[model samples]
Target: MTERTVGLMVVAIMCVLILSRGMALAAPPLPPVPADYADKHMPDGWWTDPKVLAEGEKVYMGQVHPKVNCSNCHGKDGQPKKKGARDLRDPSLVNRFSDSFWFWRVKEGVPKTKMPAWKQYLNDEQMWAAIAFEHSFSHKGQAADHAHDEIQK
Candidate 1:
């Protein structure tokens, strides 16, 4: 290819990369949990409890509620299966938010997004269980960050 053509291609690739990174970094900030949910938290040790995690996996896969399959969009392994679904495996996105924030999002769903309010089908324990399973994606072998258990007012 001509040098000019090659140079133009390089510039185009760089622009694409830069724009994508900017978009990733521009994710909306976590909205505040409503007063009722702000105080809700997972039961102690729920994050590491095998039984709880198992239950969470069921919830994630939609076994608990036929209408609530998170894997359809979030993927079985936390990678997004659909466009606009956030990658739950990314620690930068998942780990930074408190458990309360995650729980609130699951319960209420994000506005202007495909994520639907799961509260209609999921109770508190089921929602917390699903959040626990979701954390396993980004946290892997790490212990749960107990510090993020509650939302700060």
Candidate 2:
């Protein structure tokens, strides 16, 4: 109703925005895949398979297993819902990681973070499926080419 009040409200909103942006987590450094998981790869053509992506979506959405709900932290669309959760839609982050790296993260989980090891609940296929789904957010219809490049690296 008053200029002073409105100005103060705007300043408060700005401060909150700045603080939130500052609090958002930066992408963590890529950790090495352990010896056991180093050779692991997603099924050939899994990225382009409609069935695989669909299965992955289910796993990501927590439909396949209660304990395997990636969406709880990573969010259904890959925009993390919780603090410290990585933003899956970030292309820069996606491009930096290989499929095996993603798989290892899913299977083993990141240390000192909320991300838990899914190996106890998800089989290899299911974990790969979930990762494929997460990758879809960044790669979209181009996953085939992206997968090929990552595999070659």
Candidate 3:
């Protein structure tokens, strides 16, 4: 082959290799949270597990859970600690979302929001526990009054 033709062939090969590597490194897009997720049941009775709820309290309070520090922006009581934080205790807001919606949000985090994905740091069960604890805050007379003191005790 001619020298110029050989050089062009080498350049084409290099470009292909570079593009292939980039595609391999690219992460897959997160799945869209399903519309019918509200009707789905919790895995293995997560809603009724008192132990799971207790463990979730630790995670929410930044105690022994050892993953994301939820209370930094969410406050000990699930109330927002900052200007843009979601008020966890708002019944109207809490009532708007489903359990599956909460689970997906906690796992994936919201775009353009302060929430970060906890999927890397927390396991599925821990995530559910945290959700239960957050849900607890919206119930009347069930606020996390002593959540701040949980770790200390």
Candidate 3 has its poorest 10 consecutive residues by lDDT at 144-153
State each model's CA lDDT, in order: 0.84, 0.82, 0.72
For model 2, the superposed segments whose C-alpha errors exceed 4 Å read 1-29, 140-145, 148-153
**Model 1 over residues 48-83: C-alpha lDDT tens digits?**
888988999999998998899999999999999999
TM-score of 1: 0.76
Q: Tell me, what's the RMSD of every candidate? A: 5.8, 7.9, 14.5
lDDT of 3 by residue, 31-80 (tens): 55566444543466565467877888898887865668888888888788
Which stretches in model 1 have alpha-carbon errors above 4 Å?
1-27, 141-143, 146-153
TM-scores for the candidates? 0.76, 0.75, 0.63
- lDDT per residue for candidate 2 within 49-108, as digits (tens), equals 889989998999999998778888988788899999999888777767777788888998
Candidate 3 backbone collisions, by pair? none
Candidate topping TM-score: 1
lDDT of 1 at 79: 91
